[model samples]
Target: MPTQIVNIKDQLFENIFDHAPNGVAIVGLDFRWVKVNQSLMDLLGYSEEEFYAMTFPDITHKDDVAADMELLGQLLNGAINRYQIEKRYFHKTGKVIWGLLSVSFERSPIDGAPLYFISQIVDITRQKEMIGQMNAITNIANIQNEKLKNFAHIATHDIRTHLGNLGVISGFMEEELEVLKNNENFLMLKEALSQLESTIDNLNEVRKSDFSTEERMTSLNLKDFVDSAIYNINAIARHEQCKLINEVDGTFNVMAVAVYLDSVILNLLTNAIKYSSKERQSYVHLRSLESEDYIILEVHDNGMGIDMEVHQAELFQFKKTFHNRADARGIGLFLTKNHVESMGGKITVESRVDVGTTFRVFLRKA
Candidate 1:
């Protein structure tokens, strides 16, 4: 009677273990599976007998073994009572199985020594697939954006060039027929030619822009570039009585692609000259300094400053002209912004009406 009672109790415990919702496993200190429930067998596409013959390390993915062992070592040292982690395992049919694995330990009855490890596994393969899909979508979007920028450059440059040649031909006609210029159709043609010329100039700026932010950069001397920009804008600076001061130290260097940096500097300098304050002797100063993460260059000018409250939002937008100058093609600052960003830098302006404007560019430190 006693033997029959013991057998019945054992069968009841076995039935309960087999019917558990999650895959339950028992591993010994040797990292060998001592017992595995039916759930684990089905999830891994392996028979219970095959699992018993294989050790935990044999089934674990190679990339995950080191981390698994480290945590197991911690548990054995009594540092943690239990551990739960998401890990990858190899399935029997050669596919990857992502498992949420939870492990704990049981002690021996006599000496309280760890006798075995108990684990529960949950399949998370669908979640991993979803994350991979999201990454693929993000890559596609980045590629599309690059293609669009290239298309804009090609369309603007090609059309603008054709229009520019036509305007030149029209200008020649003006000199050829001074008497005919007074005619209504002749005046209208001249006005249209002038507008087309301005559009072409603006398109030329974007045509010269650099749109690749991933280009490898060389170290550029801050003062050298500033000097070159001043040289390019010398005539306007002289006309405005603007003093071009290169105060940046000779030793300061930043990482940038050369042509992009040149365009950005020239644009800012020209803007300073164009808007110089008439009330005072105008000055544009080029200075640079090193910060924690960036090399900063500042173009400080005492100029007819912008109304930040009004035109702030459109400051660097393409064709966004605020000052009503006839030659304000409205493309310099826009191209300046694009080139600055392409070289892993950013541009910002601080201005108050009648006070002055400061354009600050933050570049990658070499």
Candidate 2:
């Protein structure tokens, strides 16, 4: 009766494990597969015999090996009970497989030594590919925008010089041709000069409205700035059920224009709340990292992610709106990028639709 009960329980476990929705596998301490379910086999395009003979390393991407190995080492050292990472693997046909790998450490029942790894892999290949395409699109747009700025500078300078010359000639005509002062022709010239002056004023406004390539930078306490920004944006976050968190270390500061820093943080935080996911409670997290030469500020959000394939190019274009939100003028990111680059910094974005978005700004450390 004892034997029969044990067999029945094993059968029940097998049934549940086989029909599981996700790919599940167990690898022994020898780095050989001890067990793998059907879903894992289908996901990897390998048969039971093939997978059983292979080790996990045979399928992992080369670039991800060190990180994965490090995590495994931590688990074995008892530094962590489990580790999770979004990593890449090689498919059977030599294609890339992006998987969110969740690994838990197990120990031998007899000797209490490290035994095996239980891995649950969820395929995120599509999400990774979409982000890659979006990055390409954004790069092209940035290049074009740079060209447009150069063109504008040249065009504005030439137009301003021409207008100044026209004004001078009109003044000389009004003084020398006295009788013509009352004539419609003289009046028309006067009107033309007035219009030219107005045009130059408009051009100057445009120049001031965008970031100046030569804006002055100052040392800024990133933590203070972030705190102030969050304080100001709290009501909206509360209304949206969005929590804004600051995890920046207190020791680091950056070389940034103070006014622009305020605007960038506020605008990004607003967008984070504005496009929040309805499926869960939303969050906007701010964190910073320090390197030898750069301070990296990352603004992360769990929001209604962008359809990057369709909207990446126009994401930072002035007046280019992507979402149906009435307040999305599309100028915020444009100005944010302009201000960041103007202060000798760089910005990048990575996102997965319906998952989240992360904006990374790299600036010189002060």
Candidate 3:
């Protein structure tokens, strides 16, 4: 009895196992559970009796059992002093749990025989989940950054090109003004200057657009915005002799920024007019449909449709246009796509050469 008391004292002092908050366990050299603490039972939702009745292999996750057994063999064979690793375990209720496990060998005083193994298991599920979420967010931010970089390059190049065009025309006007002062042809030169000014204004507006602002959202009536767009572009539509057809439901609403939505709709409407087939009567269809997830708008025109093979990839790129229409500056579709995506929406096109084109806009329902 005295010897047994000394043994218990030595085990308690040398083990230093009981005070740890993580589960502490002891397994015999034969890989069976010899002792387990209160923390271990609590972690696995098992009684002490239930834990003792099973071997370590039975509780370990099946995928981890073989690897853990190999680590145990290294401990038993005196190849390692301690082993630390992350592994999964099967709880009493059959849930898989992640744990950080550290194990060391134990030796008996009698003849220095290998007695058992001591293991400490720290639960790390919450920390692991947090790491996964952080990685996902980081990936999304990287993709957004790449897209923003592309947008900056496009805006710079396009604005610079328009500025260059204005400079060339301004130079011509300077020479013409000196040669033919107040001549009737000067009115044509003045008109060109006015158009250049309009182009510069459009460029500045696009540059100043801040699509990232969360405060820009409000519930907007689709028909009202479309009407506003139509009125804004009345001159251009009238010139093209385009008939505007509206099939939108009166009460359709969407969560969007008012100015950006107005710009998007106006651009689409004008594009439908601009690309209308010269041989046929120009007609544009502004249609809307809705479902639980999205509000769908289609801008359809009987026009000289796009060639998908060569132009599909560049369709939404700045300064890219398949048609050589006189008014095409190539920024409208690019800006439209960005505006749609900025507000948690998407835009796509369906077209074939000479088969007409459909621009589909999908906005989230408010």
Clashing pairs in 1: none
The candidate, 1 or 3, that scores higher on TM-score is: 1
lDDT of each: 0.83, 0.82, 0.80
Candidate 3: C-alpha lDDT: 0.80
Indicate which candidate wins on TM-score: 2
Score residue 303 of candidate 1 by CA lDDT: 88
Q: Model 1, range 1-366, lDDT digits (tens) per residue?
A: 599998999899788679877788999999999998988988898898899899998989999989988989999999999999999989999999999999999988899899999989999889988998998999998898789778867877787777778777877887898876788666656565554455456555544656444654679887787776665566567777999998877787889866677778878888888888899999998899789878899999888899989999999998888777998998999999888888888888999888799999998887
lDDT of 3 by residue, 1-366 (tens): 599998999898656665667899988877788888778888888898888888888888788888888888887787888899888888889987789999997798877778889888999978988998999999999999879767866876787687678767767777866865556455455554554455446545555665554556778898887765665566677778888888887788988876578779988887788788888888888889997788988889888899988898999999997877676889999999998988789998998777688998998787
Worst 10 residues of 2 by lDDT: 207-216
List the candidate 3 regions with Cα displacement exceeding 4 Å: 1-212
- Leading candidate by lDDT: 1
List the pairs of residues colliding in candidate 3.
none
In model 2, state the lDDT of residue 74: 90
lDDT of 2 by residue, 53-171 (tens): 89888899888988989998898889999988998878788888899999996787789888778888898889999999999999999999889777877887888888888888878
Q: What TM-score does candidate 2 reach? A: 0.54
- List TM-score per model, in order: 0.46, 0.54, 0.45
**How good is model 3 by TM-score?**
0.45
**Root-mean-square deviation of Cα positions for candidate 1 versus the true structure, in angstroms:** 12.6
